[model samples]
Structure formats: C-alpha cells, structure tokens
Target chain A: MSGFLTLLKRDLLLALREGGALGTALGFYLIVVTLMPLGLGPDLNLLTRIAPGILWVALLLAALLSLPRLFEADHDDGSLDVLALGHMPLELVAASKALAHWISTGIPLALMAPILGILLNLEARAYPLVIATMLAGTPAISFLGAIGAALTLKTRRGGLLLALLVLPFYVPTLIFGITSISAALLSPAGFQASFLILTAISLVSLVLGPVAAAAALRQHMQ
Target chain B: MTTDAATQTWTQRLANPTRFMALSGQILPWLTIAAIAVVLYGLYLTFFVAPPDYQQGETVKIMFIHVPSAWLAMMGYLMIAISSFGLLVFRHPLADVSAKSAAPIGAAFTLLALITGSLWGKPMWGTYWVWDARLTSVLILFFLYLGLMALRSSLEDETLAAKQTAVLGLAGVVILPIIKFSVDWWNTLHQPASVVKIDGPAIHSSILVPLVVNAVGFSLLFFALHMKAMRNEVLRRRVKALRMAEVEQAARGRDTSSATAG
Candidate 1:
C-alpha cells in the first residue's frame, strides 16, 4: 500500500513538474468548448442542448491526448522495468499510474469544464451536473486508457495504437457521461439512472483496470 | 521429448507446423464442402422458410447474415485472446498460427456485419448508418481487427510479431464487454437484447430455427476459413525456411570455392 502511494505521488509530482502536460489538455478543452458557440452562433438554448455532448467529447479527446505519455516516459527511462520488478505488484503500479493520471488529467479537465460551460452559454443550474458527470466519468477514461497504454508499451507507434485500442472502450462512459449531464439539465428523474450507471461503470473499471493493465504490462515486460 | 501417446494432445499435435500443414491439408477440402453446404442451406432457410418479421418485413432477412456474422466477429476476438494466452503461457507455435489465421476471418465477418447491417438499415431505419452504440462499437471492432493485422505485418521477426500481436489481441478483448453492456446501460436507439436474456431468448421459434442454423453455419464457415488461412501461413513459413537454407548452402559453396581458388 505504501509502495502504491509512493508510486502515485511520484507520478503526480512528475506530471506537475512536466510543464504543459496537464495544461495542454485543459487548453484544448477550453478552446473546443469556447469555439463551438462561435461556430454555432450565440444561441444559449441551442448551446444548452448541445453543451453536455460537447463537454463530454472535449474531455474525452483531451484525456486521450495525454494517455501515451503515461507509460512512454517510464518505459523510456527504464523506470517501468524497475517498477515491474519492485516489491509492489504490477497492478498496484498500474493503479497508482491511473490515480496520478486522474489527478493530473481528469481533475484539471473537470475543473476547467464549468468555465468552458459558461462560454457555451450553459445555464447556472446545469453547471453542477456538468461538473459532477465529468468528475465521475473522466477517471474511467484514464483507467481504460491505462490498459491500452500497457498493451502498446513496446509497440513502435504506441500513441496512435493506444487511441485505437482504448477509444472503443470509452464509448459507454462517454454516452453515460453526456447523457447524465443532459438528463440532469433536461429531466431530473432521467439523470439518476444514467449517473448511477456511469458511477457503477467507473467503479467497476476502477477495480478491473489495474488488474488488466498489470496483465498487459506483464506481457510487455516479458 | 514427446512419446507417441503424448501426441494425442491438440497442442502437441498442432505444435508441429508440418503436422498442422498435413492435417489441415487433408481436412480443408472436406471442411470447405461442409461449410458450403451448411451456408447454402442456411441461406435458403433464412430466405424462404423463416417468416418475415411483422416489424421489419423482408428487410428482416438481413438479420440472419448480419447478426450471426456479428456474433462470430465478437467470438473471433475471444478466440484470438485464447490463442494469445496459449502463446504467452505455453509458447506454442500453432497458437501463433491460430491467432494469425483468425484475424482476417474476424475482419471479414465484421465487414459482412456492417454491409448487411447497412442493407437492412436502409429499408428499416430509413438510413444506411446510425451512430448508435451497437453500430459504433462494431465499427470500433472492425478497426481493432485492422490494427491487429497491421501490427502483425509491421514486425520483421516472426516470434516478435506473434508476441506483439498477441498482446494487442488480448487488449482488444476488453471492448467486448463494453459493447455488450452498452444497450442496457445507456438510452440508445438500438433495441435491447432479445436473445440470450436472463430468462430466455424472446424470439419465436419460426424465426429462431433459421437464425440458429445460420449462426452455426457462420461459425463453421469461420472455422473452415481459419483452417485454410492457417494452412497458407504454414506453407508460407515452410517456403521461407527452405529459402533461408538454400541461401546458407550457397554461401557455404561460395566460401569453399573461393578458398580453393585462393
């Protein structure tokens, strides 16, 4: 457990020190969310209707953009091999990486979503749900991304392959994430089911992601 | 290390590339014949015997091909994963062949699903494509197949190619569960599962019999095609080995002749 925490802290610190790793994603999210209104014209009602999908997609792509770096740097520096042999389990290492990713990528993206929400002319009432759905959802993407990262760890083109492998797995989360927020805004009762399903999926992936990733990492290491 | 009795194991028997070459060579023709017969009969039953869906009409005929092909596509991924596990754990040569052969067959199945789906969709949904969960996930599966095929070709070393492709095949298996649960979890235009329900398949027997027959036919077709593919790979590898031997023999002759001339 301590080892896992240390791994998590180290990755978090690495991400923090690596300038623009987190910022680039947030910047992209901001640009996409802000630019939509410009392209679609200033219609708050229309924006409100499309805001949830736009926010979800922006976050999805942004999360994906940062995914390759998760394993590439460690693999290059041979830290990944060292970690593979460490006293800690590979799954723990994977979990810590995912945790670090969520903090570095998911959390920051969630925080910036609401600000972008305003640019999209989203109502004040929808802000919480948008933030809430993102907060619950983006971690799943990071977790799923970790598996792809592990699989393509030794591949020549890890980044592109990572997206190809992971994005399909992202669809369910993306759908639920967008739907939950839209449901929250449009109909209160419909929101809970989607949110609950989204949360359930995240929780399930949270448990399974590390194990599957570890299995994938083991294959690569061998 | 293997005694004659030990050769009874499927893994052991298939481990010998030459053995697989011979076995598949003998079986291929018969398998092909059976596959053709079943598929033709299945298609006949699907078109003529199976009653039209009240909701979908003749357009419903597409389900016989589309749904079964889709099922096989998913099943092919699972097969690839199992073969990959075999390669990783047992380091069996035939396991690599199994994974290699299954990919193109899976891709073909996925393509069939997509094409037939569009054909059905045109008349039923009034559109050739919808960005629904099922359709999108199927598309993604197609891409995964393409990725695996591309990855296999990108490597020069045969062993490395097998290992790398195996890793990818295992990872791609994760998409299966997500696709399965997509309909139930999300509010999608795609209808919920009617077959393989918690209770039982809701489908009526009139349509169900032909569906099952076609499903079996498709599975058999996949097996037949995969065997043929594996045989082709074995032949290709044999030719490569023979060519390498010839090159080495030529090099030895050149070395000997040059020494004599000197």
Candidate 2:
C-alpha cells in the first residue's frame, strides 16, 4: 500500500521534472480548442452549442498524447523489467502508474478545460459542469489508456497504433461526458443520469485498466 | 493423468495446423455447397416469396442484405473476442489464427451493412444517411475491426503481433456495449424520430421468412469463408517455416565455404 503511494509519488515527481509531456498535451489541447471557432466559423451560438463536445473530444486527444509517457520511458530505460520483478504485483504497479498519470496529466487537463471553454464561447453557467464532467471523465482516459500504452510499449508503430486501439474504448466516456454536460446545460434534471453513467465508466475503467494493462504486460513479456 | 491426456489429445488434434488444414479442406467443399444452396434459396425467397412492404415497397428488399451483414458483423467480432479469450486464458494454439482470419470477413460484412443501410435510407429517410444509434454503433464496429487488423499488420514479428493483438483484442470487449447503446442513448437524448424503421409494424411473416432464410445463408457463407481463411493462414505459417529452414541451410553452407577458403 505504501509502495503504491511511493510509486505514485515518484511517477508524479518524474512527470513534473520532465514537464515535456505535460506541456505538450496542454499545448495541444489549447491549440485544438482555439482552432475550433476558426474552422467552424466565428458563430458564437454555434460555438456555445458545440463547446462541450469539442472540449470533451480535445480532452480525450490530449490525454491520448500523454499515454506513451505512462510506460515508454520506463520500458526504454529497463526499469520496467525491474518493476516486473518487484515485490508489489504488476497490477498494482500499473495501477500506481495510471493513478500518477490521472493526477498529473488528467487533472491538469480537466482544470484547463473550463478555461478553454471560454474560448469556445461557452455558456457562463456551463463552466462548473464542464470542469466537473471533464474531471470525472478524464480519469477513464488515463486509466483505460494505460492498457493501450502497455500493449504498444515495445511495438514499432507505437503512437498511431496506440491511438487506434484506445480511441474506440474512449467512445463511451466521450459520449457520457458530453451528454452529461449537455444534459446539465440543457436540463439539469436529466444531468444525474448521464453524470452517473459518466461516473460508472470512470470507476469501471479505473479498476479494469490496471488489470488489463497487467495482463498485456505479462503476456508480451513472455 | 490418463483422462487428462485423453482430453488434451482431442484439443491438440483439433488445433494441429496440419490436421486443421486437412480437416478444413475436406469440410470446405461441403460448406461451399451449403452456402451456395442456402443463399440461392434465400435470395429466391427474398425476391419472389417475400411480400413487398406497405411502407418501403421495393426498398424493403435491402433489409435482406443489410440485416444479415449487420448480424454477421457483430457475430464475427464476437467470434474474435471468444478467440482472444481462448488465447489469453486457455492458450488455444489456433485462437490467434481464428482472430486474424475473422477480421476481413467481419469488415466486409460491416461495410456491406453500411452500404445497404444507406441504400435503404435513401428511399425511407429521404436521405442517404441518418446519425441514429444503430447506424452510428455499426460504424464504430467497423472501425474496431480495422483497428484490430491494423495492429496485427504493423508489427514485424509474427509471435509478438499475435500476443499483442490477443491482448488488444480482449481490451476491445468494452466497445461492444457502447456500440449497442450508442443508438438508444442517442435517440433518448435527441430522437431522430423522423427516420422510419425497417423492422416496423408493417413487417409481415412473408417479409420476415425470407430475411431469416437469407440470414441463415449468410451464416453458412461466413462459416465457409472462415474455414478457408483459417486454412490459408495455417499454410502461410508452413511456408514461413520452410523458408526459415532454407535460410538457415544457406547460412550454414556459406559458413562451411568460408571455412574452406580460409
């Protein structure tokens, strides 16, 4: 248990020290949001209407950009091999790494999402719900993403293939996330249903992510 | 131990590439006959026997193609998922081959479904497409098939590709439900109530019978195609092995010649 926290802390520190992945994901997310209005035309009504979906999609892509950092650096440096032999189970190790990712990458992305919402000409009332939905939804991105990252850890077509494999799984989260926010904005009465669904997706991914990642890690190592 | 050995032998016998080839070769002709006959009869039923819909008139014929392909598309993925589980848990020797072989068949069926559905949509919805739940979900299913195939092809090492894709394939289980629900939830939130359904109240038994027959025919076709593809994969592996042996022999011969020259 302590080891889990220690591993999580170490990964968080490494992510902060490197600052490369974190910065790039944030930059990419910001750029995508900024570009939406230009591409779709400068229609404030249009922007506000589509803001939640655009934000959710961009959040997903940004989180995807950070996935390779979850395992590639460790695998490349050979610590993954050492970690494979550690006292803590590989499942726990995967869980710790993904937890660190959620805290470092996912949380920051979620925090920045509402700020980016303004650029999309989002409704003032939607600000809180956008942040909340993103915060709830982004963990699924990090956690479920760990499975794809681990599977592609040593493959040649690393980044693109990782996107292809992981994006479909992200669909439900994207659906529920966007729907929940839209529900909140349109009808807060219906918000709980989609929001609860969003929460369920995150919790399911939170548990299944490490288990699947550990399995992929264990199998490929053989 | 003897009983265990007996059960193991049955699995080994079935899974052995050489044996699979021979058995499937024998089964292939019969499967082809079954596919052709059933599909012929099903087509006859679809066009001749099945009554035209009161709503769709002629476009109702499209369901004969669309629904079966849609059914097969989903079933094909289910088959791959089962094979993935087999590879991961049971370590079935042929599971990887089964998963790989099913992709093209599955993708083709998915594409057929989409095209046919679009054709049907033109007359019924007065548009070529509708972003309804079922159609959207099937499109996602098509993408899933493509992803599996892409992941398989990208890696150079056969063994590594198999292991990686098996894990990748297993992870795909989560998407199936999303595909199932994308329509209902989409409808719930923003009902595309304008587009009429193919399987509406107007579907008489005459229309349904041919649809069922055509579905059975397509199943036979899927089975035949699957067996033929699986056989080819087994043979491809054999060709790979023989080539590797030839390369090793050439290397050894070069070594001996170099030694003599020295």
Candidate 3:
C-alpha cells in the first residue's frame, strides 16, 4: 500500500515538475472548445443545446493527448524496469500510474470543462451536472488509457495508434457522461441513473485497466 | 488410463504444426466443397424459395445476407478471443496464427454487415443510416477489430506482437459486454418511443429456415478461410525461419574465412 502511494506521489510530482504535458492538454481542450463557436456560427442557443456533448468530447480528446506520455517517460528512463523488479506488483504499479494520470490530467480536464462550458454558452443548471459526470467519468479514461499507453510503450510514434486503440473503449464513458448531463438538463429523474452508470464504468475500468496494462507491460519487458 | 494416454498422444500429435498442416491439407478440400455447396444451396433457397415479406417486400431479402454476416462478424471476434486465450494461457503455438488470421476476416464480415445494413436501411428506414443500437455496437466492434490488427502490425517482434495482441484481444472480450450495454442504454435514452425493430416479433418459419441455412453456410466458410489463412501463416513463418538460418550460416562462413586469413 505504501509502495502504491509512493509510486502515485512520484508520478504526480513528475507530471507537475515536467511542465508542458498538462499545459498542452489544457491548451488543446481550450482550442477545441474555442473553435466550436467559430465552426458553427455564434448561435448561443445552438451552442447551449450542444454544450454538454462538445465539452465531454473535447475533454476526452484532451485526455487522450496526455495518455501517450503516461508510461513512456518511465519506460524510456529505465525506471519502468526497476519498478517491475520492485516489491509492488506490476498491476498496482500500473494502477498507481493511472491514478496519478487521473489526478494530474483527468481532474484538471474535468474541472476545465465547466470553464469551457461558459464559452459554449452552457446552461447554468447543467454546470454542476457536467462536473459531476466528468469527475465520475475521467477515472475510466485514465485507467483505460493506461492499457493503451502500456500496449504502445515500445512502438515508434505510438500516439495516433494509442488513440485508435483506446478511443473505442471510451464510447461507454462518453455516452454515459454526456447523457447524464443532458438528462439532468432535460429531466430531473434520469440523471441519477446515467450518472451511476458512468461511475460504474469508472469502477470497471479501474480494475480492468491495471490488469490489462500489466499484461501488456510484461510483454514489453520480456 | 490407457484411453487417457491415447487421447494425450492424439492431442500431442495435433499440436505439432507439421502434423496440423498435413491434417488440414486433407480436410481443406472437403471443407471447401461443403462450404461452397451449402452456401450455394442457401442462396438458391434465399432467391427462389424464400417469399418476399408482407411489410418489407424484396428489401427483406437483404436480411438473408446482412443477418448472417453480422453473426459471423461477432463469431469471428469470439474465435479470436478464444484463440488468444489458448495462446496466452495454454501456450498453444497454433493459437497465435488462428488469432492473427481471424482478424481481417472478422473485419471484412463486419464491413459487409454495415454495408448491407445501410443498403437495407436506405429503402426501409428511408435513410442510409441511423445511430441505432445494433448498428452502433457493430461499428464499435469493427473498430476493435481494426485496433487489434493495427496493434499487431505496428510491432516488429513476432513473438511479442502475438502476446500483446492476445492481451488486447482478451481486454476487448471483457469490455464488449459493457460497450453493448452502454450503447443500448444510450440508444434508448435518445431514440423516439416508436422505433422500428429490425427483427420484428417471432420470425416465421420461411424466413427462419433460410436465415439459419445461410448462417451455417457462412460459418463453414469462415472456418475454411481461417484454416487456409493459418496454413499460409505457417508456411510464411517457416520461410522466415529458413531465411534467418541462411543468413546465420553465411555470416558464420565469412567469420571462419576471416579467422583463417588472420
């Protein structure tokens, strides 16, 4: 347990100290949301209606932008090899890195969604729901993205491939996240159902991501 | 105990790639003939025997192909998942070949399902596409197949690629049910109350017979293609191994000549 926390802390520190990774994802999120209005006229009502979708989709893309670096830095510097040899199991090691990714990248992206929501002229009522869904949803993104990151750990120019591999898995999260917010905005009752399902997706990925990523990582190490 | 020993030896014999190649060679021709015969018979029944639907008319005929292809598409993925299990857990040599060969065939069937589905939709639904639950799930399945193929092709090491692909395949198997469920839920949330279901309540015997026949025919075809593909992969690997051996030998000859000169 201490090893898990230590690895998580170390990864969080590396992400913060590294400087550009988080910024690039945030910048990409901002740009994607910013471009939406220009692309589809400055119709505030139209933007308001589509705001939840645009926010969630853009957040997913932004999260994807940071995924490739989740394991690459450690894999490159021989730290991953040392981690593999450590007392902590590789599955927990993977889980920690993924949790760190959620803290460093996923949380920030979710938090930024509402701010971007303003640019889209999002409904005031939907703001809290958007944050709620995103917070519940992004853990799945980080964890599932960990599998992609680990799978492509040794591939040259793996970013695009990782996106292809991971994005399909993101559909459930994207669906539940957007729908929960939309449900809350349209009707009060359906929101809880979708939100709970969204949280369920995160829990599933939390277990799945580490086990699968560890298997992939073991293959790479071999 | 003697019967158990005999069964073990039988499995051991089949596990040998050379033996597998010889056995499959004998079976391939007969399997091909059976598949072709059944498929032709199915098409005959589809065109000549199966009556046009009361509601859909001739466009309903597309179900004969579309339904079967969709079944095969899902079945192909299951085959890959099982083969991957065999490769990863049992360490079966042929399992990797089976998994690799199943991917493109599965992907092709998925594409066939999508195309046929849309073609049917244009006439029936009055649109080329709708984000219907089944369509969406199959589309995601197609992407998963593409992901598996792309991951395998990008990695250069054959052994490592096999293991990695197997890992991804198994993960995909676990996620498929969740993806299906979420897509279904999302569809229900967005869809209008009066939606047109493709398979209307209790298919009639006339429609059911041809659909089942085509399904069986297509499944046979899928296995034949898989067997042939495995053969090609086995032969390809042998050639690669022989080439590597040749290079090693040539390098050794040069090293000996240089040593004598020195």
Per-residue error (Å), model 1, residue A104: 1.4
* Model 3 chain B lDDT-worst window of ten: B188-197
- Mark the regions of model 3 whose C-alpha exceeds 4 Å error after superposition: B1-12, B178-201
Predictions' DockQ, in order: 0.31, 0.65, 0.84
Q: Please write out the lDDT profile of model 2 over residues A1-222, one tens digit for every residue.
A: 998898899999999899898999999999988888889999999998999899988888888988987888888888888889889999999999999999999999999988898788889999999899888988899899999998887777689998988887888788888878887877779899999989999999988999999988887667
Runs of candidate 2 with Cα error greater than 4 angstroms are: B1-10, B181-203
* Worst window of 10 by summed lDDT in candidate 1 chain B: B1-10
Best by TM-score: 3
Report the Cα lDDT for residue A208, model 2: 90
User: Which lDDT tens digits does candidate 1 get at residues A1-222?
Assistant: 888888888998889898678889988888877778889998888987888788888898888889888888998989999999889989889989998999999998988888887777777888898889889987898888888777667677767777777776787798788878777777898899989989987987897778778877786676
CA lDDT scores, all candidates in order:
0.84, 0.86, 0.89
Weakest lDDT window of 10 consecutive positions for candidate 2 chain B: B187-196
Model 3 lDDT vs. the true structure?
0.89
Residue B131 displacement (Å), model 3: 1.3
lDDT of 2 by residue, B1-262 (tens): 5786577776566777777777788989999999999999999988788878887797889889988898799899988999988887888889989999998999999999999988888877888887666776778788888888988887788877887787777777766776555656565322332223555634467877788789899999999999889988888988999999999999999999999999
**RMSD of model 1 against the true structure:** 3.2
Interface RMSD (Å), every candidate:
2.8, 1.5, 0.7
Instruction: Please list the Cα RMSD from the true structure of every candidate, rounded to 1 decimal place.
Output: 3.2, 3.2, 3.0
